[model samples]
Target: MNIVYSSSDSYAPIAGVSIMSLLHNNTDADEINIYMIDNNISDENKKRFENMVDKFGRNIVFIPRPDLNKMSGVDIEVGRWNISTFFRLFLCTILPDNLDRCIYLDCDTVVRHSLREFWETDLEDKIVAAVDDCRSDRYKTELNLPCDSTYTNNGVLLIDLKSWREMNVEKDFLDFIIAHNGNITYVDQGVLNGVLAKKNLVKVIHTKYDAMTVFFDFNFKDLMKVRRPEHHLSEEEYIEAVTDPYIIHYTSCFLSGTRPWNENNNHPFVGDYLKYKSMSPWKDFPQYPDVRKKSKKMMTSVCNAMPKRMMIAGISLVHSKLYPMVRSLKGKRRG
Candidate 1:
């Protein structure tokens, strides 16, 4: 199985924890080859990745990072995300030509089960398959996607390299970036949804594969209330996804403003993360503190204290309506 990851120097250790989890859980797979897009990873971190993977009898390759500025000549707004986030857009150009497909995982993900079934999924004519994002249709409208489009999270992707190269989808991604003047709030996620979500080229897979934090923290009804998604996983599927997740995606919580690695976080999957972290080279790494400001933490408390419906209405108004408007206006001004 070929898997891809991208990380900056500071995040390399976190990515290593995820990689170690994957290597441990999928010992049954015949071959597991990793390719990481490096953004100046320290030699020590590189050696850690090498030694850890070697311990599991897996092969890994490191690819040099590219200049986003040089490629686009447009100022890209990466928000709080590392610039390495855009590396996925250039996978067809960066990965080996002979490789037709590979699984792309975000550094925040911890693999808990064998990925052989997910890896063998038939893409048919689709260029990519991923779990749908738990959000409102308003986000699709924000992205200028069709109402019928199912917007999937880009965190865990089964990418078809042959199809991407053949269709020159990178051009589509670049055009979206250039057109938006790189002022996307959601960064590469915006590009993926804007470019591919409407074309019926992105298949929405089972949510279990990329079970994010929201599913665990909120039930199906509250999720609908908060996210106001036009469509989403059913209650049965949602329950199963979170309770028996195959891969735990430690995305930040709206209420906590933190992930499992943070000392103050209350992530349900923290135990799972700790299990793999203990076996990683960075086992001695310190747990991160909750870095959200006092004001932000206060707001989080306020939001949690408010009636669920009120919190839902307010966040939807800001997230789906106001926040996207700001992104669009910023893009237009930049353009």
Candidate 2:
């Protein structure tokens, strides 16, 4: 089976972690062809990836290209690189016509189960298949059409290359985006929703495949209300329910700064994230505990160096006065 993943230097850890899990868990496919498209990755990271390839003894297709530096100047308002332009670029330049189908997984996701089932599932002549983002109804509406529209997350997409190319789907998406001038919020994903909605080419898959964790208040109890056994857990319960999840998408939560490696950050799937991270070839790159300690020391030093650090510009005063309250707020936020 062919799988496509895009990697940039900044998010190398996520890509490394994702690749490691796929190689470790997936045994159903005869050949796992990893089409790694690297953009602005460091030489060290590339060497690390090469070491993984050597260890696996499996075929990996490396497609090297110039950096996306040109697009860097373009304002990325909605999704990554704006939805319209990114897809057009990928389909027109990055992908090949020889391969008729492939599974595209976002770097921030972890695949726990074998993807053979997903890869083999019939698309029914559709260009793509994905799961709905159940976190926010408003985001889905802006992306999918009507407010209650079931907007599938583009993080995990099953693409039929033949259909996509034949229908000029990418061009059509770009045309729409050009017409709208990239005003949409969610970029390529938003356009994918709009395009597929118009053609009725998207099939919604099971929720278990792309289980997403949104904000702390993502209504896990509502999940229990669904009669479907697959979707039966409450949000809080779901966080701890590690029954070999197919995919765990750490999407927007990582945006504001709490990473899996941060000691202060308590992720619901920290254990799982660490488990997958450990499997990666680059796992040894950063020692999380050491890094966290170093970061804390630096922050403390910088704060202490300030002239009024402990005086009136008072974070120290706040700490003294509201330390317990701050701790309480943090504790409440933990999943």
- Candidate topping TM-score: 1
**lDDT for model 1, on a 0 to 1 scale?**
0.87
TM-scores of all predicted structures = 0.96, 0.71
Give candidate 2 misplaced runs (Cα > 4 Å).
64-89, 135-149, 215-219, 222-243, 254-257, 287-335
lDDT of 1 at 39: 92
Model 2 — which ten-residue stretch has the worst lDDT? Answer: 222-231
Model 1: CA > 4 A from native: 328-335
Tens-place lDDT per residue, model 1, 1-335, is 99999998888878998999999999999999999999999999999999999998999999999888778879888877888899998999889999999999999999999999999999887889999897767677767787888788889999999999999999988888888877775789888888888688998899999998888777788777777777878888898898899989988777757787888678888988888889999999999878877887888889899998788789868766676677666655766
Backbone clash pairs for candidate 1 read none
Q: What is the C-alpha lDDT of each candidate?
A: 0.87, 0.61
For candidate 1, give the lDDT of residue 63.
98
lDDT of 2 by residue, 253-292 (tens): 3212355655554556667778877877666666444343
Q: What is the lDDT of residue 42 in candidate 2?
A: 87
Give the top-scoring candidate (lDDT).
1
